[model samples]
Target chain A: MIDKRVGDPAQAVADVKDGDTVLIGGFGEAGSPIELIHALIDQGARDLVVASNNTGNGQVGLAALIAAGRVRKMICSYPRSSNSRVFPELYRKGQIELELVPQGTLAERIRAGGAGVPAFFTPSSVGTVLAEGKEVREFEGRPYVMERWLRADFALVKAELGDRLGNLTYNKTARNFGPIMCMAARTAIVQVSRIVEPGGIDPEVVVTPGVFVKRIVEVANAAHESVLVAQGVTYP
Target chain B: MTAELIHAGLTRDEMARRAARDIPDGAYVNLGIGIPELVAAHIPPGREVIYHTENGVMGFGPPPPEGEEDPELINAGKKPITLLPGASFFHHADSFAMIRGGHIDFCILGAMQVARNGDLANWSTGAPGAIPAVGGAMDLVAGAGRIVVITEHCAKDGSPKLVDACTYPLTGRGVVARVFTDLAVVDVTSEGFVLREIAPGVDLDTVRRLTGAPLLAAAGIKTIEP
Candidate 1:
């Protein structure tokens, strides 16, 4: 019985400590683990370094966490969102730090972190301002900038389905960073829409294997950030 | 000014249609957010193009009908999309691997500035206090096999977009293969901005005047039919 199910979002995120590098999975509101993020907010961990695609939209999820001053830094490709003002304001006043990597490079760095690679060379930011202060080397007559791997102390992810064994699947584009972040973290806590039996999911379609996942909390009906933002909902 | 005079040369959609014609059948294409996204609707009939969105979908279909939008099913621009028959989802690493690995055929982008040397500066203006958001622009420019930019001939303030050198931050150095502007179809060659086609009713002199860099007419320059 390799059951990794947790009772609630609070319990799932209870162990996150201050100064941990957390990978919050989502490309905007799509795959955001809202309940878990809100729970982490209530749990009151401070000075977190979060890595995600965007800062967040409106005043919920990642934005709320940032508003709560729980995040000290953001490592992302794009920090601005259509409805996000939290990151920009904080960034302007120098309250938060930012490390902007190109989207593909960010993905590859996380993949490299999970795959046990220390660093890799890429042409994504070569000769651009983003490539400044980095090591540049040419291979086969083409220049490439070296980017280091990105690992997190914990990864909070949202998934479509999960079994007691922790194997998971995701919904559409929401699957963007979930699978990779799971592998790149010391502990991957997932909030799934449904929890099933061990044999419920097809083995071939499991996006995040049970090995990378530590805890699974069923969020049955997850709230979307767009609807929340539209309703002017602000998290605690 | 009459409407005819105010709306001169190819329209934005027409520019996209013209750019769409260059995409070969069965090619894997990535469309940047704005004007370049229009290229898909105008892709020639009978061509089976596989669309790739960097957010982790391949063979993406048209936008879902109104009211059926799924927030999770989206394109690289974060707009809702449908899954085409051959659609498959993968993680971010594999998605970018298809790109940086040189597996994608074409990537069409919108540009803020394009230098004669093919340098692009679409990501930022380098303005102080402006929060820069690069997204996948740099990756697409660096990895896509053929980088074609579709943009207006001039900026809103009437400054030339096709300039001698990009004044803003660079997305890539000498990466643009071709450019489709409202006024003309241009190619970025070692020689300079070579005009391949001229929009009907627009003269070469107007293009040369608007272009910040010198423009060269290619041999047998044709009138844009779209």
Candidate 2:
């Protein structure tokens, strides 16, 4: 059993070391573990290999890590304009390594890791560049490409609410990358705005149960910067 | 009543060429994944349509040749894609911004079903044991200037896919503008559904008979010119 309560974001993220592989859960700022990410950035961690569905918004999400020059490598489905400047420049200068995976395959790889399935096969990448250097197998007379599972040393996730036992719930798009990432990493750290007692959450509503989560921190305001940037505009 | 026969059973590539011809120069377009992706390959030379992808790529191009595939470049589906000049990648936020902000002028999406009222339900079929994924179809329908659907005319069961109403989960309500199927080009207008042109070798009545919904004929409907 893992402790659901932690001292602070810094302490939870302190377990991360240089050159460590980490998965930060988010799909464009929806469910990003902003507190832990801020801690990692503030700590000035370097040479990190970060894996996620997409980079954070510029100056706000995981892009901050790239902007801080902390990420030495990136494994993702796509690199967008928010972090686009960093990738090509670093690749040209031979400073960073970038590995792109098919989005569905990437999602499956992480899901497989969480499920303890070492590998699986799909036909999506066959005959494409994605099939290069990968083992190919035939099932039912059709070619299927095999992809390995993705595991990270640490997984940082954000949730809308959690129980003292670490069970979590997410809202809308924020749920995109959080639940699967929680199981694919060796240590799962979560940040939530509200924490309730164990058994307080309904089992049906729990997106990620307590067993997979190792630590949890409470953040007063996850979108403070974005709100400040928006100033007087009301957010829904 | 015309004697000119438009070719039926055209290849997917040919359908792509037909679709690309309708996209005017200087339009910002979004190509849905799968067969719709081929549209980028057939873009007419000298046309300046900027491609916006949900994965945060704009000014997109075709896939790179084998051995030259850059792992860093990919499309909305996460497949490796190439970037044209003046292309840029941004965080997913900005990518959705381009979509939801109405910066896109055209969206050419593949469809499972299109209704007489122009309702589109392409994201998930809701079929048991089928893959369930909705992606960014909702944003494309609501944000793009025009929503064009590209798909085949019928299912394997020989049932017409163009229906009175979509049976599958709808990505948007009454959002489609025009549709290009294997057999015909139809427009969803305020008056009703109208057949603009039929594919070569297919008659307008045959096309109408195969469709499940009521379809009206354009005043000067004819076989589509290649």
With candidate 2 superimposed using the best TM-score fit, by how many Å does residue B16's alpha carbon deviate from the native? Answer: 14
Residue runs of model 1 more than 4 Å from their true location after superposition: B1-7
Candidate 2 Cα outliers beyond 4 Å, as residue runs: A82-84, A224-236, B1-226
Compare the candidates by lDDT and give the number of the best one. 1
Predicted candidate 1 versus true structure: per-residue lDDT over B38-89, tens digit per residue:
9989989999999999989999988999999999998888899998887999
Worst 10 residues of 1 chain B by lDDT: B1-10
TM-score for all predictions?
0.98, 0.55
Model 1 chain A: worst 10 consecutive residues (lDDT sum): A73-82
The true-versus-predicted C-alpha distance at residue B18 of model 1, in Å, is 0.3
State the lDDT of candidate 2 residue by residue for B114-215, as single tens digits: 888888887666565432344566656756788998887876667778899888877666788998887888999886589998888788778887788989
How high is the lDDT of residue A100 in model 1? 88
Candidate 2 has an lDDT of: 0.74
| DockQ result, candidate 1 | 0.87
> DockQ of candidates 1 onward, in order?
0.87, 0.04
Give the alpha carbon lDDT tens digit for every residue of A124-165 in model 2. Answer: 445444467999899788676788998889999988788768
